[model samples]
Target chain A: MKELKILAVIAALVGITYYGIEPYAHSVMHPEVSAADFTFKDAKNVDTSLAGNVENGKVLVEANCIACHAIEKAGHPALMPNADAAASYGVVPPDLSHAGRIYDKNYLANFIFDPVSAMHLSHKYPVGGTKAFPMPSYNWMTPQEIMDVVSYLQSVAPKVTEDKEGHKATFEAACGRCHSMAYAKFDATTPKDSIKAYMGATPPDLSQYIKSRGEHYLHSFINDPQVLLKNTSMPRVGLNEKAQEEVIAYMEEIGDSKKAERESLGLWVMLYTFVFAILAYLWKRKIWSEVH
Target chain B: MAEFKQADSMYEWFDQRLGIDKFVKVMMTEYWIPKNINFLWAMGVLLTVMFTLLVVSGIFLLMYYKPDINMAFDSVNYTIMQEVAYGWLFRHIHAVGASVVFLIIYIHMFTGIYYGSYKRGREMIWISGMLLFMLFSAEGFSGYMLPWGQMSYWAAYVITEIFGGIPLIGGDLVVWIRGNFYVADATLTRFFMLHVLLIPLAILGAIVFHFYALRFPHVNNEAGEFFDFDEEAEKYLAGDKKNSKVVPFWPVFLSKDFFVLGFFLLFFFYLVFFHYGFAMDPINFDKADGLKTPSHIYPEWYFLWSYEVLRGWFFEIAGISGKSLGLMAFGFANIIFLLLPWLDRSPMVKPANQRPYFKYWFWLMIADLMVLTEFGKLPPTGPNAWVGFGASLVFLILFIALPFITKAEAKKVGGK
Candidate 1:
């Protein structure tokens, strides 16, 4: 009779567990929003021709962005002094080196057209507390030109393109700025002591990252590393929803080729365990018969 | 009773050579346990399984995890989850396991409180478990910092800054804990080391001590009487006591243990797979920016009650700043478990369920904790602040009044 009572309690516990998770699973788990819509008065002309045209976008970037924003990566200092520009603007212009990995095209285009609004800037500080250093809105230049400049910025952004193919595209694009990924191609001949260091720790090799952590771990992680984990020095890479999915999809494609196969096997494991439980229960009841 | 007499030939050979037979006879097959213990006895075994799962999953996570600030979050988010094979399963197991461990611990503790398991000659056993709970809180706080999320940053700042509210050397102490002027790489490095290695070893030592402190032949039952174990053992060993009532630890309890463990596993895996986000704070999704301080900062659910107590002291008292007093109150609340043995002055050792007034007070304390925990998540203003302040006073009164309240009730019931 007592054993039956225990079993009844176990059944109730399972019901309680289901109840505990129902509300959370329903309301919080599968969040629904209208696809992060960001449209404007004139988006049609900008949206049509300049989606992925790298060539025409480069020319537009050279004409406008080259004055302050250096898009390309190079070994030496810029030929022109940028100190006067910083003093006048009150803040150094952020490098557009990995803008593609950092910012999605939608945000980049939106920011280009209206920096004050897209970046949540207040009217009190048109250029973030600098009255004279306002970012000139390219809204006057047909949205096509602004989009072309965005395309140009993304085209120049660092990407892992089969060169070693170990460090990821987004990883190389964002993290490669300060960290070295040479460890990806390290071998028997490589000198361990000669390895480059960044941020006081050996710039971690992220070659096997996707194959090792929990799924859905990266979305919030990349959105805001510090917010996801506190006191972390990792700045938000600023990927929009679509770009975030693309990066993660690329990572999953490369890192976990056998993911589908492995997850499919979980069913077999549960089935085997369920069968064993029935046998185990019968054996336990038989063994305890004498005691009662 | 001699189930091993006709064991396999290989086992007989090994037992003769290595004393395996004698060891098993002494410990496993021969060890006797009381048969009347309730369902709550399963919690200890449940806790052990949870700990083992945490360690195993933690090791897998630590393998690909980068402790560096710039690399840590990205490595966990992008590399591990996206690239690793079954990495998500392992990480979820560890993350969800941390939250579940506390739930199991609360059950284990309340069982002890309800059954009066912390009776005469078993003070050390209770103390060891309490000490382990303290260590777990530290481990949880440090591990939370590893993700470097928004809550991780602000919670760390808010909690650590409370130390700066100290009269003297508080500033120095804050820097000492952070290993810098603010939370940085150095803090993360130390937290990683402690979470992975040092603290786990200490917890393991505490578990060993807790088991050792469980005195022989007396499994403190709901009847609440401390039996004379030496006298009971002598009669049983001499074969003069026909009604031994004690059963071998192997088949009797081991089978039941496995049965209970199966249910726990089902419950645990369900959470790890489907509902892991329930324990996680949503605000933590944003990256930590030092310049931006979030409007409302809250700790994890387990720490909320204490955080509410800390926040309750909004008004200055006795010439000391409320913040400084709050720091003291928070620290004391955590350490207050140490006073449990002395605080309840009832001479009777009856199960708390039998003590009517004590039972009422016990539920009140639990309700008080529930309210404080809820208030901790809300903005500290309006009813949330004032009610939480009132609740904090009630929390103190519950502890202070326990001995007097329970003692008076015992006289009416004639329990002793």
Candidate 2:
């Protein structure tokens, strides 16, 4: 009986050891990396065709930008194209394809050299007008590289357009389920207190008010609402500044567009519940095994 | 007639109730314990009891202990201060108990070597005992780090990095075990799991098998005599003539054991209560931060010999990169101990029976160990390192040359 007891104890120990150490062994043998391959050359490679002069702007990007940003044609796998514009690495990669049509060489040059002073938004690149991602400063970049990159960008980028119809449809598809039109009338019986209580803040009527706010302010406010208001309750709309401005313009043209307001909220609720259910199931299984 | 019948009935009833006769029969006939066992024989039982104490106290502590780096030190303090009832007593007993265990085991091995217990028919037992000693050391050192104290942190960092001395893949191997460039949360967590679970379980199993093998031939005494059955008396006796005193183990040997146990308890209580055992260092109360190197780093006293040897060897070879040679010498020193049972082979088992040459070398080894330990404790200054290095080289020479001298002495005696 004593021998049997010893054997049983040894068996249990061996079982536990195998279970505990095997996972660590597996982890050590194989390390995990993300699918996005961000190489150094892509961010720093200078486009000679964009700039009339042969400049070393690519070297500046390599030293300062490649740590976080990837500027290659492949950008990042998760980013998708919308309305012929492509978002890169979940951020709007300002398209140099149309730079020549918009800002002049000098405006672009000033913006690149000291972006904080030129943009007046407390950040260099205010994508979707939100501070979700901030561009790192390249103070070490020489004045010539800055001029060359800006000149290169100005030569290649296309003219900026104010298209409303395409943006309105996409906005409705993505966000209409969650929000109501800013000007949707409140019922007399529906207490004003309900709006403050339900929305958790004063919901603004954007139908007429949005026109007064320029495309830049509307774009900045939606992309990163906190950048404009320190305590804004509005969730970041997750759009790039250019996309945000287009959406705001689209909303103003349609005056009280109801499609986006109705659908976005329900989709968000369903998506959250689905994720919660899967997590709950896994947790329950883990607890059950421990108890047994 | 009636009185005689009543007495007979009483005898039968007593036999049925107590089974005293059967117990006596088993005690007299079935028990085969050796009669020639000595003080060194008690070490096995003492070690067993110490291991039991450690495991029981460890489990109790583990109940309240949290192994995470952020929580480990606080949890130990909590165990002592708030959570478990009388937890501090158990924690201190276990902590001090570890040192005491090693102390006893070292004496046991020294006794074994002095009496030549690792001779023919007992070499396997000695080897197994040596393996157990190594395992125990590993178990204790690994467990020390689980508390994530300042000493535990520094001790682990210095010790584990010793493996980095292995030429080509050394640095990578150390980093792999550490899970980062420096000892961090991953290293703490890994050490904790190994300490609490893996190594202890291995040591426990090995100890059981070790004793099982030990029981077969029984213990060799200071007189180096085995047991011989006296056919005329129907009992076992020592092989040696002068030492052949036969006594039942229960009454005679039990008395001596009780006397030893009493002294042991007195000393233990005095250390635990009156003398105030190992002081809990305030530095150990702090968490391990690898970026912050401690002013002085030293291992526990038991490891001082090897530590000293490495330090001394490095110092002597000052021109030849002390760090590399010091690490190599320390490792080589440990491997030498592992080779002892095979290295020292003589027909004689007892110290008195052995040649004078072997005796001198044995004492010299002990003295070298003490000097090395002292040298290990000193900082590796240029002069100290050189002195230590010279001392380490002398010790190594004595250690290797002793066996050859013993062999030569044995050959001379055989010729005579």
Candidate 3:
């Protein structure tokens, strides 16, 4: 019993002594630069340009991306067979022939920065699950090199449409990494299991996405999916406001031709629900009062 | 239907046949503990909670973690952080939980010292705890290797190099551990299994034995009476004054335990939500590059003190190599705690407060450990090296000096 008070007092002293000596000990012990301080957190930011020449872009793609991607469809085979690539990486590299016709340019640029973080494919296809992302990060590529590659992809890809009002080019560049449409090479001959293998969950065919989600919702969501659903697997695409609008325009044009008609039909359904609710409330009150 | 309390409730139906309620009562409700035990006893419950968090969160992480070196980085960064549903939260909880567990263990040791928990017949508990500490260090190291990042690769390289300091078999032993000429696919696979399976199971087994050992002795309290239950009965028969004073373990100790657990979890959640990256080195984000080494490499914060002590032996010694002396100093600094039960020659089983100079020495050790930790974090050059050397020397000296000093102090107590 006598020892208890002393133990308590010493324990408190231990706390006080450690805290009291800490500030002084750390400052003196590490008067010089510490290795912990030699980190990239304090690194200076360098500005990089993502604009480059298409002719140069073609050369860069052949130099860099062409080993895996066949730009002209027949000239280049993958360094390994498609089956070998599939067995190794889960997803065989797709042909670059239609890449520019399917993906958004702004989104495509960011994807090149960090494919894992940008695409957020980690959770969708886990390690032992049917698939996981196999894209090697080209994080070493300069901003200009990325733009040059994008230009080359755009240069080689066939026009989805020459229509001035449509964003066919942007759609082909950004969304085409995962989704393909009715006229795409993948649609008819592609096996259902093959889609599930790489995508984990077969991405709902996006040809009618605007029809289901509506135009406004698509605009907001194209920038970041996690805003609506906190646990969304999709990464923030990090598109500028104009790029987001352009992506939405493409979806509106291709995905939902009858969007106006569907929205007009929604008003009548809401009106009917309102009138029925009022009628039901009055009838309930009348029946109860009469009983009383 | 409204009755919530009964001696025999819903589970009693099964309990009557199987004697399960008796087991519950024996383990929890009727479990006797010393009344004078302070908030320090709360650490045992807290440590259990920490272990549970580690295992639960670790299981969720394992679902997506690839053991292969080729895909390990992507498995953690791309799929887990970017795409996995709430994978970031689970990962943060795990990473943060590891450091927090070590923090609790450090304090838990201090708590034991104040109450003289290692004294009397409780030596087994202290020994088993030391074994847990050793295994936990390995567990932390192996888990850190799983990400296959820049620091992960280098840390593996640096730690394995220490084994090569052994005279003849060291070279072969390191090669065997790596299962390769270097840290590679095989090393990752080995570490993944050790982190996720082998070490955790070992720790669980040790914890079981530790508490089982404690059941016979009861908890050492602030009074440090070291009283045997049978001795208490003998005293009671002789009509001597006795104090059995204990509350049921269910309401009193359990409530206090959960209160500490709740407080700790609040801090844990706050860090996971707001400042999860506080302890994590950003260098680890980079994928493993064998060609490039970071300008400075050190182990995790928990290992800083020993690493610094190891670094202090770089200066020339008379016969032994610097690495050998450093290795010896490192081993002694870490393993000395294990020997304290035998080394502390004091006859009395009283707590630190009851002793004249024990508290002063303990406070000095804490300050020394803090200084060593600082030296470990910094490069061993300039003033840091000198300080490191001084701290390492003192750390070794304390172990030798303790038993003799404690014996003299007891003699001064005049045959109490």
TM-scores for candidates 1 onward, in order: 0.67, 0.52, 0.60
DockQ of each: 0.10, 0.01, 0.02
Off-target runs (Cα >4 Å) in candidate 3 are A1-292, B1-13, B228-244
Per-residue lDDT over B1-416 for candidate 3, one digit per residue giving the tens place of the 0 to 100 score: 34333447658766665679788777886676665666678888888988898999999999999999899976886576546776766777788888778878877887777667887788988888888888888999999998887889999999988888777898998999999988889999998989988999999999998888888767777677755655553443344423543534665566656655655565666655554443455557667779879766778778888888888887778888878999888778778899988887776677676788676777687778877877777677888789989998888887788988778877888644
Could you tell me the lDDT of residue A151 within candidate 2? 53
Whose DockQ is higher: candidate 2's or candidate 3's?
3
TM-score of chain B of each: 0.90, 0.84, 0.92
Ranking the candidates on lDDT from highest down gives 3, 1, 2
Decide which is better by lDDT, 1 or 2: 1
Instruction: Supply the DockQ value of model 2.
Output: 0.01
Candidate 2 residue-wise lDDT, B1-416, digit = tens? 22323336766767666666787644543333444454445566567767887899888888888878888875775444334565755676677678768767876787677777786678777878888888888877877787787788998889888889889999999999888887778888888778788889888878877766655555566467555534412533332322433434444344444444444444444444333223233345445666667666767656767877776754334566777887777877887766776677556666533656678877677666655665565566767677677778877887678578767866766732
Collision count for each candidate, in order = 36, 29, 15
**Docking category of candidate 2:** incorrect
Winning candidate number (DockQ): 1
Docking class of 3: incorrect
Question: Chain A TM-score, candidate 1?
Answer: 0.48
lDDT of 2: 0.57
